[model samples]
Target: MRSYSSYVLIAVATLLVTCHALHKCPGIPGIPGLPGRDGLKGQIHLPGLLGPPGSLIGRPGRHGLPWLQGLPDSLDTERHDVLVNLKHRLSRLEGVLALNGKIREVGDKILASNGREVDFASALQSCEEAGGTIATPKNEEENKAILGIVKQYNRYAYLGIKEGQTSGQFMYINGTPLNYTKWHQYEPNGKGMEKCVEMYTDGSWNDKKCNVNRLTICEF
Candidate 1:
């Protein structure tokens, strides 16, 4: 038969051993449990039923105020005036250009094709479009065109026909048969053996050569 206190002491020692066995020795700690349903979360608030969505808002807001002011009348008037002036100048230039052929000349100076400006290239192209060939002193049309370009503009230099070129002979412009000629130092001996012709300021042709450098005539 055991004594009651001895039995109690033995039970306590056994309980301690059982608790130690349940937990591993030098054990690794467990991950904490899932946070527990969040406890219904966030204030448990219910928005007061939204108050029926706000009434139509004061009669559609009254139209908006006519946008912006249109431009003033004076601005329109000035723009129209500028356009008219431009048109007048353009017309006057065209009239003068027409006169140069009878007033006979080379056309423009600055050989744009050589250092050819775009405008001159276009003019050359335009003439080609019109069934006209590029004008040279020898060609009758070139002699005329030169006069027009010269009289209209001042900043150009019109190169003259060389002193002794005669016409009716095969002159060369890129190897094309430019037989046209003008005589500068001589007069019209009925388009003389002077096959090479140079242009005169009064709008006429004379015989001359390719080498002469006179102020050239150009159409701008």
Candidate 2:
């Protein structure tokens, strides 16, 4: 009877060992779970912010496109305003000069005399201070214009010409050679001794001594 009991006990122990090896405790439910695949991408959408009112172009009461806001105008309005103001001022200047009649405009050049008689140096200083130069005629029309003033005052006026280092050769105050001249016959006879020039009432020019007082005529 004791031997039979021992055999039964051994069989039970062998069966328990085989069952424990075959079955696991499920590893604590695999910690969490297997990683899931990524989801599909979503569509892009832009968020709007408060902006300025839209323009009424192409549609009444409708705003302009957001991207076109604050754009510059096609026309330069500031430049236009400046031009208009300049033209208005010029017209007023023309009217005033006409009324005074002391100044004469020939083409774009304006010739005027202040009725003051002074030496060449003083005359040059006066004209330059007033933003002009002693009357320098470059053509027949300009010479005639200066002549009118000379005749008006009935006095000879100093011309803006000087004897060059070459003696009888004359030039403008800035050292440019004379492009036009109305020298009186047998005039310019003083040579280097008469460095300054004066205009006669007959629209002719004569070289004269610089110290002699002559009419103060200026050209602008």
Candidate 3:
């Protein structure tokens, strides 16, 4: 019984010692786990503030193509020229109308169809002012036409025909020969030193003084 008691005491001491050693020892480190699987990607961030102004600027864009040319006007250059010429002719016609009391156009010739009575010298001046000469008949038809125009006033009219260098011989004011004449019987007998010619209402002509006043005629 004493031996049994001794064994029990020894076992108890051994158990106590083992329990104390276990309590004092440090714990073993565990193996690091594989890095945790990457978490879901985060949201995108906002843009940063603008940087400082640049030193150099880009070149200007090419100038826009020149504006398309406008279409030409209805009156082209040639038509414009014609219009200007017509305007000039109209202005001239207006001037002619103002100068002559009445005018008649006879196949490219403009004549004073009607005129007031004035002295021969004054009549010549008026004709010159109107850019014409005294009435000068070129043929029998023209003489008849002139007589018809002047006879309406029922008066003798001075003619452009006058005595040439030779007395009693007549010629036109333009120095042309007077190839035609219709004289009343026994008239123009070189009476009173007559130098100019006058046409009667009856279409006859006679020598007369230049100072005589009568209805006038002008031709151009």
Candidate 4:
């Protein structure tokens, strides 16, 4: 009986030690679970209270640059008046130039196309004063040009042709032989009486008294 009792005691002690070791040992890790469906959206938060009113609305910012100085009103007015006067002066100058241009045009036309009428002696003197001579046509072109001026007057005009040293022969004022003649029919009838020649409105040459007043052309 005593030996059976000892065997039972030993079996109980061994079983208790085995139970204590199992309680202290680590266990195998388990696999993680699948991700859960997205949680319901979080609630929205309300805006925070407004900050205290900013620094009692600070003083206005300073100007970046100084204001520009300006001319006095009186000086500005004076300058404006001076500009107006200058414009008027310029306009007057333009008008004077226009008048001068007109006068020059008329003078050129007269010099090219016509001459004034005067006594034969005055005509000769005028030609001399103007640095020209009494016109003497030496060819058909010159005759026609002189005749154009004489026809405008529609009257007798003095020519430079006159009796030469030989009584009946005619010559130019400059002593050139009168190579061209346009005498009218039945003209030069005065043998030694007529000393000068004149052109009629018809452009024909005729003997005339030297002192006669007539239109004249000066040639340069």
Candidate 5:
């Protein structure tokens, strides 16, 4: 009971001191405080979150083919793995290196047709896909055979050699009569300049500046 009374006395003493200090507080005439500078403008950016920038093709409408969902703006947010994978697929596009060191681009259909050494059948199909035509000449007499072949497929075409500079030594395309260049002095004669052009079956070319009227292997 005595401890409780002592605590009450201490609390009364603290209140008395606070009251005395408030009473003694003077009427201080106010001095002006420094005015705060106006707050800086917030960033002047647009309010709403923005979408990805338009592509060169712009955003595609819904025709129901492959469509790009908008890409992420942040570089860190983009899926780099997908782009890497697409690049890899592009590099692996199926194609064949021709005997002439030219490229014969093809699709999966070409790979399916199996043949000995090379796949001419599949290559022909690929050529058609590429808007080119094909032909087969049995012998030297069949140089005109390409006309029928071209008429059958695209109006324009290129002849593929069965062997390098061996089978008939030439072929034809549309109608323009091209050939392996077999050039010599004063060739394709009978006139002042009736030059004859020739091509080996191996894609090699020659021209004769004389009157020897050799058959041509044309490409339109």
Candidate 6:
């Protein structure tokens, strides 16, 4: 009986070896296991580049302080007295200037003449050299004053009025518009041709050629 059992076990072992050599006895597959946990987070290498600068500006500064004190009362009184004294001195000086036959005072204006006849250009130069300008009347009183000088010289005198850019439009040498005028009847007919103005013996104004000889009357 022992020999028989031993022979059967040897037969079984030989069969298992033959199956493995022929690769015919593969094991049965098992069921899959559960999923694994997530891995650790990655480490940062370097920080991101710096952001651009801000565009906002600063606020405005505060206002300055006000003035402290006022002027003294005695200063006001002194100013008034000084102005009165200056006006009196000016009146005396005007009187002295009028005492001479060459200077005539009408109102606050002083009209004078070199009593010489010259063209309009020469008259302007002569008056400017004397620290005065050609006589320009702003009113009838001033006009009469200039007319007196013209009558005294017994010749026509060039006034400070002239034709402007437009014909028949007159202005002062300083480019101010005419505030007063004494245009004679049917006068200023030359239009653009007669640029200079002259005072007649009758104390009226007429537009005349600049080259004409006229008395050099100046005003201060």
List where candidate 6 sits over 4 angstroms from the true fold. Answer: 1-97
Top lDDT model: 2
Residue-level lDDT tens digits of model 1 in 48-149: 111112223222233443322334567658899999999999677656755543223234421111222233334345445644433455456655556544
Each candidate structure's TM-score, on Cα atoms with residue i matched to residue i, is 0.25, 0.63, 0.54, 0.48, 0.21, 0.58
Model 4 CA lDDT for position 12: 44
lDDT per model, in order? 0.42, 0.80, 0.68, 0.64, 0.35, 0.79
Cα misplacement distance, residue 15 of candidate 2 (Å): 84
TM-score of 1: 0.25
lDDT of 3 by residue, 59-147 (tens): 32234323222224543566899999999997688568745535555555556735588877888888888888888776767777678
State the weakest 10-residue window (summed lDDT) of model 4. 102-111
Task: Between candidates 1 and 2, name the one with more favorable TM-score.
Answer: 2
Model 6 collision count:
0
Off by over 4 Å in 4: 1-115
Off by over 4 Å in 5: 1-71, 74-79, 95-199, 206-220
Candidate 2: tens digits of C-alpha lDDT, residues 162-189:
9989889899999998999999999889
Model 5, position 121: C-alpha lDDT score: 45
| lDDT of model number 5 | 0.35
Best-to-worst ranking by lDDT: 2, 6, 3, 4, 1, 5
lDDT accuracy of residue 178 in candidate 3? 74
Candidate 5, residues 27-122, lDDT tens digits: the string is 233344455786554432222211223332335434434443333445424567778888877556532323222222232112121111123344
Model 4, 81-111: lDDT tens digits are: 9999999996787567445531111222222
